[model samples]
Target: MVAADGGTDRASALVTSAKFSEAAQRHNFEAGWLVRDPWRASTVSDHFRRLVANRLFVAL
Candidate 1:
């Protein structure tokens, strides 16, 4: 979950969901979802590098 200033909030929510739900935990880990704020260049750059290195596609 990536948003301008709400990335942490969104990620936290997902984490909470996974914490309580077995299906959510499996899907979350399998999907490898992460939170990144575009304003944070370093984090975004790191995510981009990982994606490229893994040959992964961004859903959005």
Candidate 2:
């Protein structure tokens, strides 16, 4: 999840706590990208490009 606030620890903790079933069984749960607001167009584009390159987007 891309967060406007770059609080990776908080995001990680939230995801960690919300795990259930298959998610809970997986041990590799991790908070991925964290992008702050006031983003430039190039920066957003670059991030999306990288995510796509890495096959990170399941949709969009």
Candidate 3:
């Protein structure tokens, strides 16, 4: 079973409270490309850019 908001703690809390089991389960997290507000694109892009900027870059 896959939950859309599974990435959030609230979803996990609800699932646990419902007695849903994840034991021996293969997990996958996908950022669904279904943002309602179109303006979220710029916001998400900027956030990603900032995150990458803060990371140390190494050249091999």
Candidate 4:
């Protein structure tokens, strides 16, 4: 049920399963925060840092 198609053999038209690695997830979130709210990047960065330190978001 990703896109393009959603039935038997639907994955044929799709590319990825939408699953990303831990590092990729981190980078994506950081970049998204920058693009979404540059002014609040620092605050968001600190939040993510804490999450990472607490092993809540990414393991690395």
Pick by TM-score: which candidate is best? Answer: 3
* Cand. 2 Cα-lDDT: 0.45
Please report how far candidate 4 places residue 33 from its true position, in Å: 6.1
Model 4's lDDT to the true fold? 0.42
Cα lDDT, model 1, residue 24: 64
For each of the candidates, give the backbone clash count: 0, 0, 0, 0
Please, what are the lDDT tens digits per residue for candidate 4 over residues 1-60? 112222323222212334378876766543211122333443445566687799887843
For candidate 3, the C-alpha RMSD (Å) to the true structure equals 12.3
The residue pairs found clashing in candidate 3 are none
| Order of the predicted models by TM-score, top scorer first | 3, 4, 2, 1
lDDT of 3 at 24: 27
Off by over 4 Å in 2: 1-39, 58-60
- How does residue 44 of candidate 3 score in lDDT? 51
Order the numbered candidates by lDDT, best leading: 1, 2, 4, 3
Tens digit of per-residue lDDT, candidate 1, span 1-60: 332443343222111223447776666654434444334534664565588678795645
Model 1 TM-score is 0.29
Best by lDDT: 1
Reference-based lDDT, residue 36, model 1: 45
Q: What does candidate 3's lDDT look like per residue over 1-60, in tens digits?
A: 122333343332111222324642435332324343324544454455565688843222
What's the residue-level lDDT of 60 in candidate 4? 38
Which tens-of-lDDT digit does each residue in 1-60 have in candidate 2?
333333333222111234456765586454434333334433564566688889986535
| lDDT-better candidate, 2 vs 4 | 2
Q: Rate the local accuracy (lDDT) of all candidates.
A: 0.46, 0.45, 0.37, 0.42
